[model samples]
Target: MAATPSASRKRILTYITDDSNRKTTFKKRKKSLVKKARELSVLCGVTVCAVVCSPFREIETEVFPDEGGVREAYARFKGMTQVEQTRRKYSQETITEERYEKVKSKALKVSTGNQEKEMTEMMYQYLSGQLMSLPAMNLVHLNDLAVVTQRHLERITEKLAALGKEGDSVLMPPPPPRAPASMDMGGGMRNDEGNGMYVNTNNRPEGPAC
Candidate 1:
């Protein structure tokens, strides 16, 4: 007598630890599970929801292919989760705001207290002559220092200008010859001589003028 297929096939759950093996097993199991779920839902005509978490805590969903039923279930689940998350977030924000206000108030109070203490010390020093004991400390002394500094700055500027002028004097070119009174044209100068003969300065004859 031949053994039946069901008798040979063992229906037992096995955990796979190897990365590649786990992935292969997960794919096969997921397909089989979804197929079985769909078959059951169609055969029994019942609403079903299935959620699976892999070993890595990643979630996977397999719903009966009924569009309306899947959508309704998803909407309810998502709506509830969103409401809870929003409520928790608002509560956190309220607590944070209260803490911030408390910290801000304390900081202001401490800062004001420090400022008052400093002002009191400064007033006491001003009333006594302790502030005047230091030489060159008063406003008049400061003004005198500023005037002396300004005068020193002016002297330095004058020295720099004098040095620059001396440098320019050393680099000076020879002065050009003054033109004759007749050659001087008030608004425009003519290239030709007043006698109408053109004088080519560039090609001048190598002899003294007659």
Candidate 2:
């Protein structure tokens, strides 16, 4: 058996169930942690510390930058206000986790928006006689569409509230779609300007204006 190239390989992290393997992993990781702390202190001239304790026994297993250095750093850290201390967490793992949270939030927002847009299409299909009745359609889909519609209404309410605060007049609703002229208007789809994005279909021609 041969090891795969690092660049082309993806390593999956998992818990080591075997006691011996777990112990070995802990020792190796502890050594690596201390080395990284030392390197960072030397390269950046910063007071950095790494402490690895024995999980099996009550004892200090390893400490980087010496005991005196660790004590001084600890004392300084404790002297700071609670608020300041809370804001000073800049560890690599902490920073990575924070960035991951932000990215996750953005991805969720995009997913929600896309879902709402798709649901809006479904709503139109239901209204325009392009699909089966609600009873025949999936209940889950109907629920999703209702939720999407509610969100739309909430957004409109928020915008209206903001405008009210600004003393601005409410905007007029958009004009209704004009009936497709003379070309045998029937329940069918038609391409829009060569772009396959949206197709307008009507059930029947609009009645004469009252």
Candidate 3:
């Protein structure tokens, strides 16, 4: 028969005091914790970081999804908003200088036609939510946008004019004017001497009075 397991097997939560045994247990538990954290992150599509402090030495061990994962997770844990983090990233001296150089290079190559293309691209980028990192637009960009819009309007007007010339639309004449209300008593009056006058039929007698 197999040897009966000890009480420690039944109670895995209790501490093991033996120096060598404790070290072994510590290594095993640390490994288990790291593995569980990584599995959880992968299965749930989440960010996870596990930190372990050395039992004997003054050192720390950390497990993360990637090199920069720890820093990103730490920032979120500290309640930093996405905008704040982005600002912090671009506000660095080196980053700002790099961004300025890139903008200058791009500006040197831009032409009149490219201005229209850039404006269209900027509109699409905004629609796609990719303009979060872009700098605030200036007056020049606004002018480009206005030019593009005017060109589009001109094209639409030309198409409408061509369609109209093709007789694709029917023009309906204005409705006939409504007849004037009757003024004669009990009957409509007739126009005499080109003047509109009415004589009441009820008041007229059989014979004319002198």
Candidate 4:
């Protein structure tokens, strides 16, 4: 049979007894208190500011400097009419509540209209069973098809040239160079990975990459 082990014992002690431990505790508690203050400011929609000074004279401060709460409290406490007047002027010039609501409503209406139009078109296409079929010729689609044809032609010509090279008796015609952008119906514009149109020429843009 194995012998039984002794039970461990622990005791509670004050943190401030050791100077190093006291300092460490103070640092941790200060950080926790600051975090709690920030959370209170966000959750309760209030502004909070806290300042701490250690025994060695180091000082730290945290401020919630948002629109309401502590700022209003301080303004009221100090009877700062000038500050209130400045705030009112800034708000009027930069962003008024009325203008914000108007812009938001306009954006919402435009987005809803676009979504409805897309949904109606999709439903019509599904019911007609013509979603997969290409219908009604357009300049843009024609230009895309031309580009695809040119790519396939180049591939076929390259294969023929390779075969001719491998068997010296056969001579293959050289593939024609790609047509200039101006000749394409797309007016020199190419689809850049579906993001937007771009000029197909070799010339680089002036600015840095987006």
- Best candidate according to lDDT: 2
Clash number for each model: 0, 0, 0, 0
Mark the 10 consecutive residues where model 4 has the least summed lDDT.
4-13
TM-score of each: 0.26, 0.48, 0.31, 0.26
lDDT of 2 at 43: 94
Q: Model 1, 1-210: lDDT tens per residue?
A: 899999889776566669888877887888888888878888998755555546544535444565677787677657776667567455767988988999999999997667556544544565586665434356864564455556656876788687776545656897755554346343444334455333445455579768
- lDDT, each prediction: 0.65, 0.76, 0.69, 0.62
Between candidates 3 and 4, name the one with more favorable TM-score.
Answer: 3
Candidate 3 residue-wise lDDT, 1-210, digit = tens = 665677336564567789888877778888888889899998998878756768666335645555588778887767977777667464468777997899888887777668788777776687699886655768887777878867866886788787775323434455654434453334544323333455555555679767
Query: Which regions of candidate 3 are displaced past 4 Å?
Result: 1-12, 58-60, 80-210
Give all candidate RMSDs, comma-separated: 29.3, 15.2, 20.7, 27.3
Candidate 1 residue runs with Cα over 4 Å from true position: 1-12, 54-210
- Number of the candidate with higher TM-score, 2 or 3: 2
The TM-score, computed over Cα atoms with residue i paired to residue i, of candidate 4 is 0.26
Candidate 2 C-alpha lDDT tens digits along 31-125: 88988998999999998977778785633579877889899999988999999898877887998899899999999999888977889987778
Residue clash pairs of candidate 4: none
Q: Of the pair 1 and 2, which is ahead by lDDT?
A: 2
Expressed as tens digits, the lDDT of each residue in 1-210 for candidate 4 is 654453243444454788777878888978888789889878998656655656644634434443465567676656867776576455554666777899899999997667556545644575589687556657865555455556656876798787765433445566655554434335545644443334664454668768
